[model samples]
Target chain A: MSTFVGLYNYWIVIVLMMAGLYTVIAKGNLVKKVIGLNLFQTSVILFYVGMGKVEGGTAPILVHGDGAEEVVYSNPLPHVLMLTAIVVGIATTAVALALVVRLNEAYDSIEEDEILEQDPTT
Target chain B: MIAENLPVLPIVLPILAAPLCVILHRPRLAWPLAVAVAWATFGVCCALLARVLADGTISYQLGNWAPPFGIEFRVDSLNAWLMPLVSGVGALVLTYAPRSLAAEVARSRHGLLYGVYLLSMTGLLGMTVTGDAFNVFVFLEISSLSTYALVSMGPDRRSLMAGFRYLIMGAIGGTFFLIGVGLLYMKTGTLNMADLAERLPAVKDSRTVLAGLGFLATGLSLKIALFPLHLWLPSAYTFAPSAVTAFLAATATKVSVYIVLRFFFTIAGVGESLGNGAVREAIMLLALVGIFVASLVACFQQEVKRALAYSSVAQIGYILVGVTMLTVDGMTGALVHVFNHALMKGGLFMVLGCVVARVGGSRLSDLRGIGRRMPLTAIAFVIGGLGMIGVPATVGFVSKWYLVLGALEAGLWHVAAMMLVSSLLAVVYVWRVVEVMYFQEPEDAPEIDEAKTDEAPFGMLLPTLVMIGATIWFGLDTDLTVDVARRTAAMLLGGGS
Candidate 1:
C-alpha cells in the first residue's frame, strides 16, 4: 500500500509533527508555544486517523446483508484510542492556554526570554 | 465487594475525592477532604502492593470486561512498587500543603487549588496502575493539567510562566506518546499493553514498530526531563509554591521514569534487533551526561530550590544509568533510587518551603543567618542533603551501592567512576549549604523578633521530619525495596525479549 496517496498522507503527518516540535522548541512566546503544543497534539490525531484507514475498506460496523461472511474492515482500535486521545489533547491545550493567559496577566508579557530577564528581586 | 474492589481503589479514592473537594467550597473543609483522600489512596495502594507481592499478577477488568477489548488495570511487581511511592508521597505532601498553601497561594483559590492537587495525585497514581497504553496518555494529561494549575498558584507572578513552560513541554511529550501508541495500535490492532506486548514481537522488524519505539522513547524522555530536555524543570521547581515544588519534585518525574522503565524493559522487548545494545548504550551515555552536567549546574545555583531542582535532574540520571545497565542489579538500583530520591528531594524541597515561609524567600543569602535561628529545620535539611550526596547510613547510599555493583558486573569501570564523581559533586553542593548554615556567621545579628521563631509550624515540619525519618529507615532496611526491585527487574527482562 505504498501508493502516492498513502505516502503523501504519511509525509503530511510527519511534516506536521516536525513543525509542531520546532515551534515548541524555537518559539520564545508562551502563547506561541501553547499553539505549537496544540499543533503537536493534532499531529497525533492525524497519525491515528492515518493508521485507521485501509485501501477501499469500510468501517468496522456490520451491515445487514454482509452478516454471514467475514468483511475486511479498517482497524477500529486506533480510532477508539484516538478519540480518547483527542479528548485528552483538548484538555491539555485548554489548560496550557489558560496557563499562558495567566502568565500574560501576571508577568505583563508572554515572551519567555523577557520573563527570564526580569530580576526576581524586582 | 470490597475484596473484589481492591485493585482500582487507589485511583478511585483520589478520583472521587477531587470533585468532593471542589464542592465543599469551604477552605477549612478542603484540607481535611484532600488529606483524607490521599490517605485512602495510600491505604489502597498498600493493599494492592501486598496482593501483587503475594500473587504473581492481578488484572482487574473494568465493568467485568476482559482486556484487548476493554480497559484493564494490571498490577505486577513494577507498578506494585510505584503505587506506594506515588500514593504514599501524595499523602505526605498533602499533610504539608494546607499551611504552605495558605502562605503562598490566594485565600480565595485555596479550595480549587486543593482540588487540583488531588486530581494530579489521582492522575499520577492512575498512570502507574493502568495497563492500557492509551489510558496512560489520558491519565498523563489529567495529571499534567492539574499540575499546571497547582504550579501557577505560586505567589511570584513568574510562576505562571513556569507553569506555561511545563505545560508546553508536557503537552508535546504527551502528543508524541499518543502518536507512538497510535502507531503501535496500527501494527497490532489492540490497545491493551499485554496484548500489544504479545503482538509486537511478530512485527518487531517492521518500520512501524521502530518508529513507534522511537516516538515513545523520545516522548517519555521529555516527560522525565532527561538532561538537555530538562529545560523546563528547574524554573518550574524554583518559582512554584513550596508545596507544589515539593510534591512535583517527588512524584511527577518519578512516575514518568516508571513509565520509561515500563515501556523500555517491558513493552519494548529488551534484546536483539528491537531492544538492541545500541539503545541501551545511548541511554547510558545520556544518563551519565545528565549526572555530571545537572549536578555541576546545581553547584552554581544561588537559590536553594533551584539547586535542588538541578540536583533532581542529576538524580534522574542515576536512575536512568541503573536502567541502562539492564541487569537485575542495575534495574533494581534504578527502581530503588526512584523511591530514595523522592524521599530525599521531597524532604529537601519541604525544608526549603519552611525556610521560605520563615524568611520570605529561599535565596542562599536569605538563608545565611536563619540557620542558627531555626535549628530543627536546618538539621532536617542537612540530613536530606546528605542523603542526596549518598552519605552512608542513608537510603541514597544503598541505591548508589547497587548501581556501582551493577556497573562493575557489566565491567564498565568508567561508568562506575562517573557515579562516584557525581556523588562527590553532590557532596560539594550539599556541603555548600552546610557550610553556609553552620560555619558562616549570620548576616545580621539575631534580634528578639526573629530569635523566638524556632521552626516552621507543625504541619510543615511534620512532613519534612517524617520524610527524613524515612530516608534513614529505608537506608537501614533494604529488604522490602530490594526484594521488590529484584522481582520487578526479573519480570521485565524475563518477559522482555
Candidate 2:
C-alpha cells in the first residue's frame, strides 16, 4: 500500500508527460505543438513540486513566537527551483506563440502539412 | 583583486551589455558597443584560462554561500579550454557581423539582433562556468531562446518557419533535460554538480537514476542534433542570417556536447555512465550512421551553405566518435575538434557570407567564376574546405589524427577506416564547390549573372582570414589546443589532479 501510494503520483507524471510528448509529435498544427510543449513543461513542474512535499509538514516558514519551538517544514528548495522553471516555461510559451504568429503571417497557414505542400524548396 | 573576479565577469558583462544595447538602440552605436564588450569577454576568458592553469580549478561561490548550498561557478581544465574557444568566437563573430549582416538582415533589426546575440553569448558563457545542475537548464533556455529569435530575424520569410521548427524541437529538448535534472535532485537532494557527483554513486543502481541518465542523454542528443534527431538543423542553419549561422554553428551544438560530457562523466560518474557497454555502443553506432548519412546528404546539396550545414552534422559525428572511444587520445581529439571545427567552420561560413554578399545566392552555379571575382575569399574557402577534408597542415588534420590514433589504440581498425572514408567523402563534396569556383567558366555558371570582381569589405575579410590563419597555424603546431585538450581529456576521464 505504501509503495502504491508512493508510486501513484509518478505514474500520473509519466502519463501526462507522455501525453504531451505524443501531442507534440502527433499534432500537425503549430499552435497545438506549442500547447503540447506547455503541457510537457507543466508535467515536469508537477514532478518537482510533488517531490518537494513532506506529509503532515507545515509551510516552509520559521515561527518566531518561541525560539525553542520544534519546527517541521517541507523542503522549500524544489519550490524555489520550480519558480525559475515556471518563468522559463512562460518565456518558452511566449516565444513559441510569437514564432507561430510570424509563421502564420508568412506562410498564410499554420498547418504543417499544408505549409510543406505549398513550399518549393526542401 | 581584478583577477579574482574574472570568473564572474565574462557572464555578467555581456548580460549587462545586452540591455545597454537595447537602451542605446542606434544600429551604428549598438554594434560597436556589442563588439567591444565581446572582446572584453574574450579577454576575461583568456585570464580565466590562465588562472585555471596556475591554480588547478577556480571555483567561486555566488553570494559567498558554500557549495551544496549555493550556486558555484567552477572552472576546471575542461571548461578552461571551452572558455577561450566560445568567447573568442563571440568576439570574432560580432566583429564579422556588421558587414556580413548588412545585406541579409534588415537595417532596422541590426540593433535588436546584436542585443539578442549578446544575450546568447552571455548564456553560453554562463552555461559553461556554472557548477550547478539547474543553472545549466536556465542558461540553455536563455541561449536557445535568443538563438531562435536571431534565426527568425533573417530576411527570408522561410526563416520564420525554420525558427519555429527549432523552437519546438529545442523546447522539447529543454523540458526533457529539466525532467532529468529534477529526477537527479529527487534522488540526491542537491543541485550542486560536485555534490551530485559525490552522491550519485550511492544510488547509481536505482531505476530512477538510470531513467534520469537516459533522459539526459536523449535530451542532449536532441539538442546536439545527433543523427536522426538532426532534422531541425539543416533548415535552421541554411535560413538564418550568415552571422547567426556562423555563431550558432561554432558554439551552440559544441556547448551541447559539453553538457553531455559534464552530465555523464562529471555529474554521474564515468563508471556508472559510459561504462555501460550498451550506452557506449549505441552512441558509437549512431555517430557512425550520422557521419555517413549526413556526408551522403551533403554530397548532393545544391546550395553551399546548406552543404556545409550537413557537413557540420558529420563533423559533430567525428567529435562523437572520439567521445565514444572513451580513450585519452579519443577525448583529446574530441576536445580539440571542438575548437578546430569552430575555426574551420567559422571561416568557411564567413567565406560563404562574402560570396552571398557579392552574388546574392550560394548556389553552385553562382560560384562558377567566384574564384576570379574574389580570389581572397575563394582561397579562404578552399583552405577551409581543405581543413574540413582533414588535409594535413589544417586544424581538421590534427583532430582527425588524434581520433585515428585513438581508434588504433583501441584496436578498432574498421572505425579508423570509416574515418578515412568519410574524409575522402569530404574531399568529394568540398571539391564539388572547388571545381565550380575555380575551374568552370563564368558563362557555364547557371542562373546568376557573371559576377563582377568585387572583394568583401576589409572589416569582414580580415576576421575570416584570421580564422583561416589560425586553422592552418594550429594544425601545424597543435601546441596550445592539443596541450589543453590532453589535460582536459585526462581530467574528464577521472584522471586529473
Candidate 3:
C-alpha cells in the first residue's frame, strides 16, 4: 500500500480532531463549544476503535460444539476501553449542557464574549 | 473480609457512599453522610498506606481475574503517600464544608453538592491506586466532570463561564490522553502499567510509541495546569464556592501530577531515551518559565484567591522542576512539595472562606485591616503565606531546600538561582496580602465595621487551624513528610524503594 493510503485513517482522525479543537477555540457560544468538545471526543473514540481492527477479523467470540475452523478475531481490549470512554464522553456532555443551562439562567445570554463583557472580573 | 480488598477500599467506600448522599437527599442528612463517608475514606486510606509500608506493594485484581486480563489496583509508596493527603483533605473539607456552605450555597442545593464532592474524591483516590492505564482516564473524567458541576455551584453567574471553560479544556485534555493511551496499546497491546513496562522497551524506538509519550505528557501537562496550559485555573478557583475551592485547590491538580509521575517513571521504566534529559529538559525549561511567569502574574492579581490560584501554578512548577532533575533528592523534593503545598494552600483558601463569609468581599482592596478583625484566621493565613514563600520554619522551605540542593547536585546552578528568584517573587505576592490585611486602615466599605467583624464560626476555624498546625509541625519535624518522600523518590528513580 502507498503511504497515503496506509496512513489515511490517522489523517482523517487528525482532521476531525483539529476541526473539533478549532470549533472549541473559535466559537463563542457555550453550547457550541460543548458540541466542539463532543466532536473532539468522538474523533478520539474513532481512533481507538480504528486502531483495534484487524484485517478479515470476525467478532471476538468462539463457536462451540460445531465444526470450528481457524477464525481471526479483532483485538477486543480497545473496544472495551472505548465503551468506558464513550460513557465518559456522555457524562461530560451531560454536565456541560447543564452548565450552559445554568449560565443562561444567570447571564440571560449564552454567548461567551457577551458573558465576559458582563463579567468585569474576566 | 474487606481487608483483602484494602487496595480498592478507599475508592470503593467513597464511590459507594456518594450515591447514598444523593438518595439520603435531605440536606441535613446529606451533609453528615458526606462528612462521614469522607472520614471513612481517610480511615481506609490510612489502612491501605500502612499495609503498603509494611508489605511494599499491594496488587488486588478485580473479580479474581489475573493481571493483564482484568483491572487491578496496585499501590506502592508513591501513591500510598498521596492517598491520605487526598482523602484526609476531603474529610477536613467536608467537616468544614457544612458550616461554610450554609453561608455561601443555597439551602436546597446542599444535598446535590455533597454528593458530587464525594464522587470527585472517589475519582482522585481511584486514579491514584489503579494499575490499569485506561482506568486512570476514566477516573480522571469522573473527577473532572464532578468538579465542573461543583464549581458551577458558586453564587455568581460567572462561575458557569468558569465551568464551561474548564469543561472545554478538560475534555480536550482527556481526549488527548485517550489518544496517547490508544497509541501505547497499539505499540504494546497491553493496558496494565506493569505489563506495559515489560513490553514497551522493545518498541521504545517506534515513532508511534514516541508520539504516544509526547501526547501523554502534553495532555497531563494541561490537566495539571502547567504554565501555558493554566488559563483555566485562576477563574475556576476564584469563582468556585469557598469549600469547593479549598477541596479542589488542595487535591485535584496534585492527583494529576501523581499520574504524570507514574506514567513517566513506572510504565516507561528505565528507557535510555526517556531517562535521558531530552523530554526532561523541555519540561524543565517549561517549568522554569512557569515559575517566573506565573509568579510574576500572581503578584498583580486584584483578588486574593486569583493570586493564589496563579501561585498554585508556580508551586507545581517547583515540583515539576524537581522531577526533571532525575535524581533522588529531586524526586524527594517533588514528593515533599506535593504534601506541603496541599497543606498550605488548603489552609490559605479556607482562611479566604472565613474572610469572605464575614467580610462579604475577597478583593484585595476590601480586605484592609482583616488582620485585626479575625485574629486567628488572619494568623493562619500568615503562616500559610509564609509557608508559600519558603520561610525558614515553614514546610515550603524544606521542600525548596531539597529542590535547590538537587539542582546544585545536578550541577545546574542557573536553575538553582532561578528557583531562589522565583521564591522571592512568591514573597512579593504573599506580602501583598499581608501588607493589605495588616497595615492598611479598614476600608470604609459598609461590609467592614471595626467591632462587628467577628471571627469565622468555630467549625470553620477548627479545620483551618488543623491545616496550619500541620504545616508548622510537618515543617519542624520533617520525620513523616521527608521519610516518606525519600522512599517515594527512591521508588521513582530505581525499581523499588
Q: Which candidate should be chosen as best, given DockQ against the real structure?
A: 3
Better model by lDDT: candidate 1 vs candidate 3: 3
- For model 2 chain B, the run of ten residues with the poorest summed lDDT: B444-453
Q: How is the predicted docking of candidate 3 categorized under the CAPRI scheme? A: high
Candidate 1 segments exceeding 4 Å error:
A1-5, A66-71, A117-122, B272-275, B448-453
Candidates 2 and 3 compared: the better one by lDDT is 2
DockQ of 3: 0.87
lDDT of 1 by residue, B294-324 (tens): 9999999888888999999999999998888
Clash count list over all predictions: 0, 0, 0
At residue B379, candidate 3 shows an lDDT of: 93
Which residue ranges in model 2 land beyond 4 Å of their true spot? A1-5, A64-70, B444-452, B495-497
What fraction of the reference interface contacts is present in each model, in order? 0.87, 0.72, 0.92
Order of quality (lDDT): 2, 3, 1
Displacement of residue A105 (Cα, Å) in model 1 is: 1.8
Better of 1 and 2 by TM-score: 2
Better of 2 and 3 by DockQ: 3
Question: What are the chain A TM-scores for all the models, listed individually?
Answer: 0.85, 0.89, 0.92
**Candidate 2 residues B1-497, lDDT tens each?**
66777788989889999998888888898999999999999999998898888878989988799987989999998888798889999899889988888889878888988999999998998899999999999999999999999989976888888898899899999988988898888899899999898888999999989989888899999999999899889988999999899889999999999999899987887789887999898899999999999999999999988999999999999999999898999999999999999999988988888888878878898888788889999999999999999999999999999999999998889999999999988998999999999988777446544555578889999998998898999999888889999988888887212
- What does the interface RMSD come to for each candidate? 2.3, 1.1, 0.8
